[model samples]
Target: MLTDPTMWRPAGEMHRCLTDGGSAFTEIFGTPFFDHFARDAETAAVFHDGMAAMSEPENEPIAEAYDFPPTGTVVDVGGGHGGLLVEVLRRRPGLHGSSATRRTS
Candidate 1:
């Protein structure tokens, strides 16, 4: 099950440390590490590329498991980088879709 950060202190602390430290983390995991990814643009690019390396294979099973409503408009809210929505639209050719930062008044 997923845990909400507001309700869980350890999760929040872990996230903080991941974003904050090098020694406490690098000691356990060793070098060629994420400190650069957190700060450097080139490293971030390489990190994102590494993450994308597995995305297509990782997402194929998920794409097969679900169906999108095909005839009406579908809005994806805060959909991360639009990848999943793009995949859904690709799989469901008849659907009209839009992705928004948020639903607002």
Candidate 2:
């Protein structure tokens, strides 16, 4: 869905997320974008996967270069699907982690 131009072209036309009623996502979806993404199982999966895929590459350099402390818990704030956390944990076996992201029921 994200790959489709039809889905997002309207945002440019609509001036999204810039003015008071400016959220094109909210306007189009009739809900907060994240909430709308989470409303369906398949869509939520695609959303998280896309987010993880987009973010994972950016996280690799940080994970590789960072010199973690010998012991303690690492928190991956907004760590969608734990990809970055997994990489960090794989690199530092002694470290533990917590991932925080949206909760869906």
TM-score of 1: 0.44
Candidate 1 segments exceeding 4 Å error: 1-39, 72-83, 96-105
Q: How does model 2 fare in lDDT?
A: 0.74
lDDT for model 1: 0.54
**CA lDDT, candidate 2, residue 65:** 89
Q: What is the TM-score of each candidate against the true structure?
A: 0.44, 0.76
Tens digits of lDDT, candidate 2, 12-105: 7564455555667666667766677677667767767777878878777888889888678999877878888888898888899998876755
Report the poorest 10 consecutive residues by lDDT, candidate 1.
1-10
Write down the lDDT of every candidate, Cα atoms only: 0.54, 0.74
* Ten contiguous residues with the weakest lDDT in model 2: 4-13
- List all candidate RMSDs to the true structure: 10.5, 2.7
lDDT, candidate 1, 45-100, per-residue tens: 55445445546565556656877666776676655345666777778888777887
Error of 1 at 42 (Å): 0.6
